[model samples]
Target chain A: MSDAKKFMYINRKAPYGTIYAWESLEVVLIGAAFEQDVSVTFMDDGVYQLTKGQDTTGIGMKNFSPTYSALGDFEVTKIYVEKESLEERGLSLDDLQHLVWEDEDEDYAEKDSIRLVSRAELADVLAGQDVLFNF
Target chain B: MKLTIQVNEGPYQHQSADTAYHFAKAALEKGHEIFRIFFYHDGVNNGTRLTTPPQDDRNIVRRWSELAEAHNIDMVLCVAAAQRRGIVDDGEAERNGKDATNIAPGFRISGLGQLVEGGIESDRLIVFGD
Candidate 1:
């Protein structure tokens, strides 16, 4: 019922094997142009999309992992990585690409863009979204 | 609350259509308005009327048609996806020179804009997919 809606893009699939991950990113980039409150959640196999040191040269595909870093420039700063998902995959914050954004309010201080949340916290975030895109 | 549901996969092959249907039914039972149900990707297959499942199996397409008829819900199938998958209404059939149109009752074929509009117009846009 809020005038300004909150949008959440849920990534449940891993990248490259299917088009879902790539298409989801396309939607997020376009959604950013709307200037609405946008957030993205990485859960399930989706956590693999952010794994750092991705080398797609052997896969014959462009390595789009770096696109996550550009999200902050598009004002899509809220990137939630579910704690359980990372743990299940034996990954930590160090395994993922570090995303940061400049906080102009704090005199242009760079701040981390990723928020590590538990399953319960992620559920609350999911419930709070006005629009959800899952791919 | 106004809700818009998106189904991104075909019936039976994936649980997306079933989940979306159940979610829509539950929302309607709670008196929430479903502004639109946009079917995209393989989800457009749910609108085809030519499906003939086993007699004992539930007819997913028919179930959606009946639900839309009962609630006057707007069921929209993405035109691009439908065309690629060969799911079309009479209008699309004629325009594309197709031999037949298979879109089921209470369903309409539309552009991707309908999905975006659904998001803008509804209070909540819930997506169900694989």
Candidate 2:
């Protein structure tokens, strides 16, 4: 109920087609522009948002993933990913140009911040935040 | 934890609604209070009362209604998006000269400010999109 000093933005969709991904990114940028402590996490198909070498020119849309790299410049550097998602999609940290933490450890389930987490761990993440915004 | 869920995708068109449903149910089951479920952009389609999927398939519209009815969850459909898409209540439908209003009963037509309020009031304002 109080002012949001810390913000966590969850992105759950892929880029292109719809504008949800774009809007969510804009909101995070705005939050960071205001000096808020912003953390962004990509889940589900949203993992595609951070995939390297995206080519949207053929689709008649501008490639926007590169803009995500600018988040670090805005001080919005805490980027998280669900480890299981990466494995399920055959994606590793090397496939992404951005900072990605894959919780490949068996003990990740026990340690709250040990890298990757289950969908259930999201509740804890949300519970600990002053603000949890998903897109 | 009190939370607000912002839905920005159409029902069944993507996994966004499913994610919202599971998360909402889990949040409620965990004794967390839900402040509201605000629909925007393509999400306004979720309030359509006339949707009829195959009998063998999932009926997301009905599922949403049941969730709202059971939990007393506030279901908000964006007024601007609804107007833009021609999804309206009886009055707006009449004024617009449309034959019928497709928005269901449990969901309400509201402004984007409500979403901002959700961000301000709830401990978490989760968005489901794309």
Candidate 3:
């Protein structure tokens, strides 16, 4: 197999209101099968995608918020949530879903899938990616 | 260096198509090769030849076609997205029982694999969207 390329999905839209967040997630799931170094960055309103207790019952739409938790199964473990976005929205790490994955190389220890980073730090991450999908 | 450009929004609705065009032109002028320009989501509308913009305005579709012709650039519209947005070529129009095919010149309908392949083949993949 060829060495994996760094693929980053930049999510800047909120879920439910538009199709971007949901469609972006679908691409990440499909792209994971390619075995690339896939990472998802949540910035701007995108940070709301990970907000816990998303109940779509009143919206008459299927709740797809749970899908974010399953991303670890596809080997998409690098989920970055922008600190500035969350703060601006009056949210914190505790308000988001706790995504975890098993590290087989580290004696099967469970590791947090989401990494909270500052805007400057996220800029560095963006610069390091080989491919960036913005939505 | 080889580069791939992805435009996610439609012309007039967003500046993605315009920005991507200038980026591609600048890259070509700098002696860089553009592996492909993949249109996804509403960006597929850019491949439709049916649009007749105002006489005074710049024709985005024509500009893209002319650029593709000038540089031999591969301009591909995502088949799935195009189908959803009613953008069709001769093959798709015939297959789907449509009367006319409106795909602009120099643009071809293709699968998402082309986007992935472009990412693999190109040194950089820049996405322009809303």
Candidate 4:
């Protein structure tokens, strides 16, 4: 087993609706800053957070999606997505910028790198994690 | 694995129930355990049985009941939130002289301390919100 403990964060809601996602991200960032291994899985509407062309200016909210890419700079690189979520919303990996997405249907088990995982794989991911935080 | 879910939205008012159901189902499938599901703020609406959504739409109350029954999940609603929202059980309803009670079955009303305990006890604390 790796010495680094893994943390999984499952985000299902949209980013702007509430502060849950923001608060959760803050917590995770702090954890990563402390040198903990961290991973994030965005599903349902939460996937929108990873899309490249975020324009929150109209709503007067500062665009924070860019901060997501910065997570890699902090060595928190395990970002996952649900395949059904992408297809259900007619999205693809190209929609995201600066980050790689795991396509669940292509590799539900995530054998290679941080692959996309099905609903079934979600449990396995949750099981292996030392810390799992949902937002 | 012991999972603690933080619920922010009321039952049926948003996608909180569906998200919780998905997580509960996945956790059980993996043979893991759910430590607790802490309901807070607007999440206390999950206990209200007074909802009557359109027939075409999903029945959140029934969905939650089925999920809890099948997985034996511990579903707790915030008591303070419930009381503030006027959702009471038979005892509270009678004491307050309400004509009817809105709290749903299989949902226990309790305090936020339970939520804090849940956060501390569980291996993972997942939050489902709007």
The candidate scoring highest on DockQ is 3
Worst 10 residues of 3 chain B by lDDT: B111-120
RMSD in Å for model 3 = 2.7
TM-score-wise, the better of 1 and 3 is 3
- DockQ, ranked from best to worst: 3, 1, 2, 4
* Tens-digit per-residue lDDT, B17-39, candidate 3: 99999999999999999999999
lDDT of each: 0.89, 0.77, 0.90, 0.71
Stretches of candidate 4 off by over 4 Å are A1-4, A100-114, B1-130
* Candidate 1 accuracy as TM-score: 0.72
Off by over 4 Å in 1: A53-66, A100-111, A118-135, B22-31, B54-57, B78-105, B108-120, B123-126
Worst 10 residues of 1 chain B by lDDT: B111-120
lDDT of 2: 0.77
Residue-level lDDT tens digits of model 4 in B1-130: 8888878787666887678777778888999998777676677777677788899988777777677777777888766666767878887777778888777777787665565456556766777776
Candidate 2, residues B3-121: lDDT per residue as tens digits? Answer: 99988888888999989989999999999999999998788999998998999998888999999999999998877777977789876877779887788868988766566667767
Best by TM-score: 3
Deviation (Å) of B68 in candidate 4: 28
Minimal lDDT window, size 10, model 2 chain B: B111-120
Candidate 1 lDDT, A1-135, residue by residue in tens:
336678788898999997678767866876677666889999999999999999999989988999999998888889999999999999999999999988889998889999999999999999888777777
lDDT of 1: 0.89
Better of 1 and 3 by lDDT: 3
What 10-residue stretch in candidate 4 chain B is worst by lDDT?
B111-120
Clashing pairs in 3: none
Q: Tell me the docking grade of candidate 4.
A: incorrect
Candidate 2 vs 4: which has more lDDT: 2
